[model samples]
Target chain A: MSTQTDTRSSAVVAGSFEGDPRRYLRGLGGLLVFLLVWWVGAMTTQPSYLVPGPLDSVRAFIDLFATTTAIVVPVSGSDLVLPTGLAHLTETLFHYVPGLLLGASCGVSLGLAMGWNGALDDWLRPLVRVLRPIPPLAWVVFAIVWFGIHHTGAAFIVFVGAFWINFYGAYGGVEGVSTDLTDAASTLGVERDLSMLKLVALPSAAPQVLTGFRTSIGRCWMIVVGAELFGAPGVGYEIINASNNLAMATSVAYMFLISLAFLCMDVGFRLLEGRVLAWR
Target chain B: MALSSESSVDRESREKITVRNVSRAYDSTQALEGVSLSVGEGEFCCIVGPSGCGKTTLLRAIAGLDDPDGGSILVGGDPVTGPGLDRGMVFQEYALFPWRTVRGNVRFGLDRPACDCADCEARVRELIDLVGLDGFEDAYPKELSGGMKQRVGIARALAPDPEILLMDEPFGSVDARTRDRLHAELLDIWAQTGQTVVFVTHDIDEAVTLADRVVVMDAEPGSVQSTFSIGIERPRERTSREFVDYVARIRDELGSPIDTIE
Candidate 1:
């Protein structure tokens, strides 16, 4: 096992970012290939009701963009969106931003707290076990009742999906910090609170936090759709509206946008992770 | 038992550290029971023993990294309760922060408000230069060799000019060649600074070569088996008869004097 790991590390070191092109271009190429396959398969399908071609979806998107003049949730029955494309995107962003910020922040804090304290970690483990099994969608009813069809309703869904992953990531990162670093700090006379955390704890846990943060971002995208399905306005709502009106092409168009958004976020996250973890 | 023995060593260089009957245990096992030792200011003392003999626990207590269930350690005549700035430590692993550069690691001890005086920067630079890391100040621990990282560790420990330096097998992790080079550097640093150093090692040669007095501790429930004062002069030859005799003496104490392991 050790030999295998050593071989893998040496291989990685030998070719690690050395004349490699696993950059944005690779991501774009994959995206284009996926879309091309999707496009071809859609064109070939005998019954296009379930799968509209990319061109057909775009046509419906343009028509929806040009025609929309007012907006609300698909369930709200306030049909026409004012200058539709941007408006719907902005509405989705509103829910996503709040959820992402609140959920990620709280999750990170909880993870740090739990990882640092053994008592808290042991106490919360069983609680997390119980809470984690409950799907984020189970909270939709409470989301609607408590938030009443607002962005908060959508945000709650996203938060549920994201919070636990980040919490656990942060916990693992903090717990894995090298005892040597702590010993070094103690010897150097750094016995204070903030200094200890900054010097020894946080930096040590960074890789774990980044992994958790990245994982949470993916979960947030999933939860946003669940949020939209329940009474919140988003790209999901646009799809729901187009479907009920029997405009399957527009529904496909909305879905395309959701996929595009998630793809863009994953790419952005990888870049940020690379930059932050770079030791210099 | 060992503590009182050290207090009365009485070859004064100002009595910086005084240990009093310090005992430590883990669950049912005693690592150190009724163990005590002291170091006068400017003394180079080495604690040598077999593995699991609580040489480390003794060093930890002096640094306040571990608390003795009984007795106390007085650093510059103040009782030690917990880890503090008065004592500096160098671990076997070097313990340099992986994320920080060599200079950054050294600056850790220098960050205290007390150390932030006008001389702090110069003091840090001098130690950095003293450790022979003149050009690699900006290099992080990951980029460094084992010996280099330990140099950073040593430099950081010395940056604050603490009254005592508590080293726990600090050179144990380095290669033999690097360890030899570092041993010379450490002795030179000790001669110049006169910092009270309490170094622990299992290697008898290291204990004899670097110490004014090598305190030998027995295994299991570690006790100070004997203290051998090296009367040999500076730049002592490891190949010489005197050096071999010192190693032989410690070797004899470990088993039957008649049939001891080399």
Candidate 2:
């Protein structure tokens, strides 16, 4: 009887797990369909120079596998290979990961600080508003002159793209926290500096914090591609190289790889969020 | 008269909370003005008044959740500038942290504080049972009924083992039956702990049923208009003649049936 009850409850929970699979699965399926259409369209184009067919792209991709830097070096001294698609994604992540970490941490901290202290908000408001409108891409010129095509250059550009989003989201979240929660927390002996932001403000603003993370995650792809297009390192560079040679299929494939990486990141974060706020 | 030597939150053991010439105003509207009262140690003093009669305002001031506009409030001989944990408060809205289970909410005050009291968990369990929540400790506030949520709020207020409990119309949101049940439950908790409590309620029956003394205030710059001693025996019968007499006298003075008070 107990086993039967457990089975029934498990079945109920398993059924509810289908809650938003359509949102993710459909998104995944849609990307595949888009790639199929691109592949077919490239095949129909007779001029190989104008639109390299999927076969030509596959050949180039395979060549990269033969010559690619191996992630795990074997003691046997046999040459190891990585799939071109995966290598390109990893390259993109090199820029994406560090930029996101630095930018998000700084953004959330500064935003919270400003939101919590009215005096600080007053002091920084004018300066932040003036600087906020300048596009992150505008700094690419300086990025080139200073870093000169290094990973740091690409990361700098990526940080510029991601930071503002996190800052704004955290700012809105902190500011939107209810004053009543502050009073509630303080009534229980949690105080001013350690208080509203740490206990009440952060919890009340969780949904907004998630929004900021989502925004920063989305911005990473754009910055990655933009950095590559501007002569910075990564798979964005590969996409530019393929496009210049009119390897339309390879360019399309690289785009799909980056898209897949982003989709996986979104799914991972969503899962983490669901688990963390299980009480909600 | 009891626990006078227990160092209650008063300079004079007669008054647990002293709100002397207290007044508060929001722009032109006065929430309280020249309102003063003394609640004694271990006393279950209920404040009864009309809507917007500053009953909640007075309790908030007593809890140090709000500062009086003009006068002074002293708890244990210390002038309160802001809220302190020495006084625990329960609001009309239940005020239990919705994200926490019943036991979690009750023991929230203990989470951060350094303590060696081995019976802390046992006391929380006792409180949950005392408030009729032993089986519902794992349940969230959203899962509980209105009465149960209020019980959790009461449990939370008592969690810190504060000297006084300030309740603002805590049972007002529940139906009559549930409210009555909670009234009985609250009295049990009070009796068990001997905690000083100042409860705010507009229900005359409720005030007379639970309180040792009922303080009724008039509206518009609200201040005490009258006081009635229940003086009824323990576990007072709501339908008893004395209970009826106290309820009727206050109701008559208020000049309406319960519905007419609206």
What DockQ does every candidate get?
A: 0.32, 0.29
Poorest lDDT segment (10 consecutive residues) of candidate 1 chain A = A1-10
Window of ten residues with lowest summed lDDT in model 1 chain B: B1-10
User: Clash pairs of candidate 2?
Assistant: none
Candidate 1, residues A218-247, lDDT tens digits: the string is 778777877787667778887888888777
Which runs of model 2 end up more than 4 angstroms from their true locations? A1-81, B1-13, B117-119, B135-143, B255-262
Compute each candidate's TM-score over C-alphas.
0.85, 0.84
- Local error of candidate 2 at residue A170 (angstroms): 2.4
Candidate 1 — which pairs collide?
A70-A80, A70-A81, B3-B36
> Per-residue lDDT tens digits of candidate 1, residues B114-205?
55467877877788888888777776677667778788888888888787888999988777877888888888787666678999988888
**Roughly what TM-score does model 2 have, to 2 decimal places?**
0.84
- For candidate 1, the docking band is acceptable
Instruction: Let me know the DockQ for model 2.
Output: 0.29
Error of 2 at B86 (Å): 1.8
